[model samples]
Every structure is written in C-alpha cells, then in structure tokens.
Target: MSIQTKTVKAKTVAIVGGGCAGWSLAARVDQLSANTVTLYLKEETNPSHNWGFWQMPWLSDALSKKRAMWNSWQIITDEGIVTHHSRNHAYCSITSDDWFDWCQKRFHSAATTTEIIRLPVTNTDKNMLMTSNHKKRYDLIYDSRPPKADKNILLQHFKGLEIKTSIPVFNSKAAVLMDFRVSQENGIHFMYVLGYDQYTALVESTFFSTSPHREEVYDEAIRDYLSRIYNVTSFEIVKSEKGIIPMGDVRPKDQNPFLYSIGSNAGAIRPSSGYAFSFIQKQITQFLDRQTKPTNPHKKHDLMMDLIFLEVLKSHPEKAQRLFFKLARALNGDSFARFLSGEANIKDYFLVINSMPKWLFINQAVRVIIEKWKRIAKWA
Candidate 1:
C-alpha cells in the first residue's frame, strides 16, 4: 500500500523601508509560518526620534520598553490650563533607536528565516525589486516608504532637544502636550514638553503649517521658550531630533495586489493630529489576524472628521488653541486617549463633535465636501 502527500513551499516576502512600519511588519512576519522575509533598509541605522502613543493591551510589550510614561498630561493656553489624568491608558514614548533594537532582538529570537539588507530600493517592476547592488523577486512586497508630499499640503514639523539642566526644575509628574505661550508668527505653533525627570526633559517647538520654517528658527524658539517659561538659560544639550510629517490625505501610488503599502503611505497618519504609531500597530494587527494584505485601518467617519477639522484649521488658524482646548475639556482622559488612538466609541465621537464650534464646523464640512467633489470631477 502507498499514500500520496502534498507539500507547499513557503512564501517569499520582501519589505521595503527600514522605518517603524517596515521593522514592525518584519518582526511579525518572522514569527509566522516558514515564510522567507527580506527587509530592505534605506540606511544602516535609523535616525533617532521619539514616537509617542498611549498604552493599550496589545502594546503592553512595547510599553515595557518605553523611555518615559506619564499618567497625567496638560494643555496650556493663555486662557488657562486643562489637565487630564488617565488611569488605564498612560501616555508613553519610545525612541527610534530603542524600537529598532527591540525589533532586531525579536527577529533573532524568531525561528523563521529573515534577512535584513541595507540597500535602497531604486525601482520596482511587477514583482521584482531592484536595488543598487541586487535585484530580487518575491511573492509579496510590503512598501513603507513615505509618500511624496503634495504641493501646498498641510504639514506638521518640529525640532526637539533633549536637554539636561544643572539643577532640578522640570515637573516630572506630567507632560505638557501643548504650551501656546510661545510666538504664533508661524501657523498654529506650540511647545511640547516631556519631562523625563527633574533634570532632564525634551522640549520641542512644533508647527502645523503649509511650509516648515528653517532649522535655526525652531532652535531659536526652543531657546526662547526655555528662557521665558522655565527661566533656565544654561542647559546641556544631550541630543536633538527633527522631522516633517505631511498632514493631508496621503494615498498609495499604485494599486498592485502583491505590492502593499503598509505605513503612512497608506494613510495611517491622522490628518488633524499627525499621529501614526498606534494606527500602524492597528493596521499590522488586522493584517495578521485576517492573513491578508494590509489596508488603511482608519474608519470613514473618523477620516471625514479629520478632514473637517483640518479644514477648520486651515480656514481659521487662530481658532486652533480654542478648538484643542474645547475638545480636551469635553472628553475625559481615557476618552481623549482613545479618540487620539483611533479607538474611540460613539460617545467619544459625540463628545468631539459637540465640542467643536457649530457654524465653523459646518462651514468647514461643506468646504471639504465641495473640494472632494471637485477632485472627483477633475479625475473624471
């Protein structure tokens, strides 16, 4: 007697871009079946930057490696300060260097064959990816390269400095999400502070605008902010980081089934808030659960709300502070965190809508609708 058996070959996966999304997906894929994965890194080492997100159950492992976590955070404006405290979802931050190290450790610990190559993907033809030194074909390709910025698109840009004071000064208990006491010459400017301890903190000068200012401009702002707000003029600069994130509708360039866009290129960023870490996590989670290609994980209604909010900011930049303050005041800490993390419930959504200025929102909503219609017509 004889029996016939069938065996299937493992899939070959190629992931482009070495940023958070690429590494995150590679780590997950390394744990799956016997898939052969190749992660292409544009650079040998990732630049250091802080990725901030709120704590959630699925992110408990990442949270364990957090550089800093705060149970309370505050938003400050000329009118007053609004403090929020969350017992369940603490705001946490992790640096890019640490995240890459963690992902690498996980990759090595996994029992699958995964190779990381430091090469920029120069071109792609069908299922083949061409690098400067090598060309390879794979069953699936996940591209996390940042989407090209559209002309005149809204942008969130910031430069941060990790400073150490000779004496204790910072309040380590809470984080300053937004301090609007700084100059508003730029569009929708604010200072964000994460006090790691009494002697150490990261102070960033951020702006939501169509164009970012020069690096020196942001540096001067940070200096002025520290001198005026903290009254500390002498501090040692430990490290610095700067980044520019597009805050508009960013879509994938192609619609190939085998080639999937996995990160901000697939619209993981919230247009209004410029937050993508949590959404990227959600996208990865859904992709793994369904055993399918990843798509944009944002809900339609939430995206629409973000569009309207962005329109409001574009039309009335002066109202930015008030809008943020009102929205923060309307929701509790948990609700606010959930809303920002894109896990808000109906009640949370309602609170956000109710907190906005009625006429302003209506006007912006109409504008967004008309703009979308015009785009469709132009395409047609």
Candidate 2:
C-alpha cells in the first residue's frame, strides 16, 4: 500500500476503465494536470455503449453527434399525460460510440501527459503494474471496474428499446419521465422519449430486480407498452440498450491501500434513481478540487449522498417507489420533465415528494428517524 503525497512534480494518474466515468475523469484530470495522466481501458475496442443524460451544458464539450437534443419532456400515468416546458435544461443524448469519439478528441486536444492505454491492469500496486503483456506504474490509481457487490442485495436494472416509425405516436418536443400506466407492480418504472417524432423514441422499463432476470421483464413490459399505449406494432428497432445500476447501500470496506474505487465501484451511483453520469462527474470535480489534501481518495464527501439516499432506498423501497411515482403524479406534465433534466430546484424536489400520500411520506420519515437512532445507538 504505497500512499504517495502530491509533490509539485508532474504526477502520473492511472485511471482504469474507459467508460463515461473513466473518460470524463481523464478529460478533467487532463485539464487540471500540472503533471501527467494515463487512461486504461480493459477492452481494446472503442466504446460501444449508449450514454445519455439530460444535457447539462457543463458536459457539452464531451457530448458527441450521436447525442440528440430535446427541448421538452413529459411523464405518463394512468391518470393522464403531463408535459412540461424545459426552462433551464435540455434533454441531450449521446450514443456510446459518439461519447467515445468525443472523449478521444478531448484527450487529443490536451497537452498534459495524458495517454489512454488499451490493456488490462494488474491487481497489485506494489511493483510496476505487471500485466500479462505490459508493465506500468502510477503515482495514483483510480479503478472504475464494476466492484463485486453483495448479491443478496437487490439492484435496480433496466432494458431500453430505441424504436422508430413512419407515423410518430410520440410528441417530438416532449420526453416522458415515467409512464405509470405501465403498472406499478414489482417496483418498475417506465418512460418514453420522443426526439423529433421521426428520429427515434427511447422507451425503457426499470425494474427493482436483479440483472439476471431483467431481460425477460423488460421485453414483456416494452411489448405491452407499445401495443397498449403507442397503438403501433410495426416499428423498426433502431437500437436497444440495457444498463444495470446498483441500488444498494453496500460498499467495499475501506480495506484497499493503493487502489481507490471510482464510478459505481466508488458508490457514486445515486441510490434512488441509478443516476451515475452526473454524480460521478461531480465527484471527479470535487476530487480535483481537493486532490492536494492528505486523505484517502475513496474517503470523501461522495459517500454522504450515497449513504443518505441508500438509507432511504433500503429502509423503504416501497416508499421510495411511491415517493417517485407520486412526484410523477404531482408534477405531472412539465414539472416532471424539468425535474429529470436536472433543472428543478430543492424546493421543487420537496414539493413534488411532499405531494405523495401523506402517510407514505410519513412512513418514510419515520423509517429514516429510526434508522438514524440505530446508528447513533451503535456508535454510542
């Protein structure tokens, strides 16, 4: 466990894994690097994942042409369809291929000692990292590979289908957050996004289930949504993608010395919503801000939000579901739209959550209180 201090010298940062989190961190480190930075991707191939988020201007430079831009969004429910005009945010999307191109372009533009190595990293940090084929060393290591999680814990997974048609049944300007009409059973959330009617629509169903059985559930849900809601059976499958995001509180015990967890491995994914892109970006920004401090890279404020939200999620999974769905119902149209786009404020967030059946919110509140007491008692 070599814990090196940050001297004025150009320190080498070896970031393992070249996904959105790894690439984005590399780009930022390149910007901040008074020293050198290196990126390692396990796969020798270019990126092949579809990455998307409500387009925040902060990440505009990293967005690729596969990124689609939308101005409005919606949330569908059994009650009715509600739409909101996006005021502060635009729904932007980028495919994995496009995002890879964008990051490589940025890496190319940077003058720092930034290099992306396409090889697997050796598990040991003692000597020069000796891979089966190569050797390398770094002043610091950031590993973003999927951490082995406790399987007994449940994780929320989703499979999305990107469909296109000649006769668009979706509103070109609006993006749906969650279609509650898709049944609230087994902790599932459904959503649809229409990008300019003819371009394509991203429809997804999220299940608070395991990665193993998500495909069948998603396929069945998608087919049902298309037939009952869209009233269209003859649509071309433009593309399909699925993502597994951990929604549990369990994390790696701070037992590793030199290697620090990053991205989902670092507990950067939001527990309630499985949103990691923005969260990991935020963590990287903060890490850069305090990189000079004498502290463990993994032990930071990043855990605060994760812990808080995870408590809510684990203690009251049903309440978590109810809270979100109720917010979808309360905010309905445009409010729900702007909220997902990351434009809504704290007041807006609370107002929407507050609208759920008061008893459910009360139950959530009580659970939180009890959990906190247990923690305090244990510490005492």
In candidate 2, stretches whose alpha carbon ends up further than 4 angstroms from where it belongs are 1-10, 32-35, 44-47, 63-66, 126-130, 183-186, 210-214, 250-254, 289-322, 329-346, 349-353, 357-359, 365-380
Q: Which ten residues in a row have the lowest lDDT in candidate 2?
A: 293-302
Candidate 1 lDDT score relative to the true structure: 0.85
* Model 1 lDDT per residue over 13-108, tens place: 788987888888777765445468888888644358898999987686579779999999999998889999998999999988888788888876
Q: Which candidate is the best by lDDT?
A: 1
Error of 2 at 1 (Å): 12
Residue by residue across 1-380, what tens digits does model 2's lDDT show? 24454621236667778877787776666645647777877864432545556656555564446456666666565556556555545666667676666667777788886776777775554425556688877667777776666675557677777888767587666666566677656665565554546546877777664444647878888888878877877788877777677765546433355666677777766555666676566566556666642222223333343345455555565555455555665673345544544445666667665775666446656776687799899999
Q: What is the lDDT of residue 317 in candidate 1?
A: 92
Candidate number with greatest TM-score: 1
TM-scores for all candidates: the values are 0.95, 0.80
Instruction: Assess candidate 2 and give its lDDT.
Output: 0.62
